[model samples]
Target chain A: AQKVTQAQTEISVVEKEDVTLDCVYETRDTTYYLFWYKQPPSGELVFLIRRNSFDEQNEISGRYSWNFQKSTSSFNFTITASQVVDSAVYFCALSQWGAQKLVFGQGTRLTINP
Target chain B: EAGVTQFPSHSVIEKGQTVTLRCDPISGHDNLYWYRRVMGKEIKFLLHFVKESKQDESGMPNNRFLAERTGGTYSTLKVQPAELEDSGVYFCASSQVGVSSYEQYFGPGTRLTVT
Candidate 1:
């Protein structure tokens, strides 16, 4: 069975503070994909990032960065200078290669106070 | 380009009642997907459709649920005699034929409340 775990059920921080949401996954397949999605209060899920198991290079886009460490089976997301707009429920998901469906973790609700 | 779209932004029904949710995917996209997020739980895949054909329905909860994507344009999910435990947010997503699953564009979900 494939599983994705988001350890933080909720996190709150003042505006401009940095916050990291941790995700850990377990899968038997050697080739799989990990994803992060943000669902704002408006009720739409916005795709954040996608990282395959083969790629361990950390990625940075603007104030958002992701760390993927195969050694620990972890994919962590960090938001630098988080703003009120960043408040939302974030989800970590996993899927094996050629699999049609995603297995998601219990989402983490984030609150950013201005 | 238009993104995926789902109808009935919110729905409330009593137990044993029936409800149907609709979704319209992006133009020309051949892959459509259905997912659900129960309260306080994770979002999970309900099914997948390639055009009008059912590609996968392994995650479907039970027989009371039926999905149809006629003409390969839009899709509908019907729940009959919905139980209280069936209430949750139903999401629809779509991606191009050659695109990877990572590119599935999601629609604003339909929130279902069973009383």
Candidate 2:
């Protein structure tokens, strides 16, 4: 079974500050996919990023970035110069190949204070 | 394109009552999925439908949960004799066939409150 762990339950950051959310996962499968999602106050989930197992490269999309390190079984997401809109509950998920199911971690609620 | 849509954004039912939730997938999407998030827990998969057929339903909680995708356009999930533990937010998502590597578009979930 694949399990994702996000240790941070809640985080608060002032506007313009950078924040990193830590996520660690355990999976026996050699190949799998990692994903990040954001659920705002409205309770609608929005897909953030998806990284395959083979790719350990860090990714940056605008002010959002993700670091995937297979050696530590960690996939961390960071937001730079964060705005108030960044406040939401973020979840890290894992899925194995040939399976449509995504195992999600308990989300981390981030509050961006202006 | 319009994203996946779910009906009755919220539902309240008494214990032992039967409730059905509906989901309309994106146009031309062949893959549809159902997931739920209970209080203080992560979202868990309930089932997956590829067109009119149920591709995988291993995550369904029990026999009381029945899901069907009729005509391959929309799907319905029926929970009989709902328990208090069944209260949660149910989400529906859909992905286009052969599209950009299984990117699923989600709908605003239905919050089921079983009392």
Every model: Cα RMSD to truth: 1.0, 1.0
Clashing pairs in 2: none
In the range A1-114, model 2's lDDT, one tens digit per residue, is: 889999999999999999999999999999989999998987778999989899999999999999999999999999999999999999999988767678999999999999
For every candidate, what share of the true interface contacts is present? 0.74, 0.68
Chain A only, candidate 1, TM-score? 0.98
Off by over 4 Å in 2: B99-101
Reference A-B contact fraction recovered by candidate 2: 0.68
lDDT agreement of model 1 with the native: 0.92
* Model 1 chain A lowest lDDT segment of ten: A93-102
Per-residue lDDT over A1-114 for candidate 1, one digit per residue giving the tens place of the 0 to 100 score:
999999899999999999999999999999988899999888888888888889999999999999999999999999999999999999988987877588999999999999
lDDT of each: 0.92, 0.92
* Candidate 1 RMSD to the real structure: 1.0
What is the lDDT, from 0 to 100, of the residue B75 in candidate 2?
93
Off by over 4 Å in 1: none
TM-score of each: 0.97, 0.97
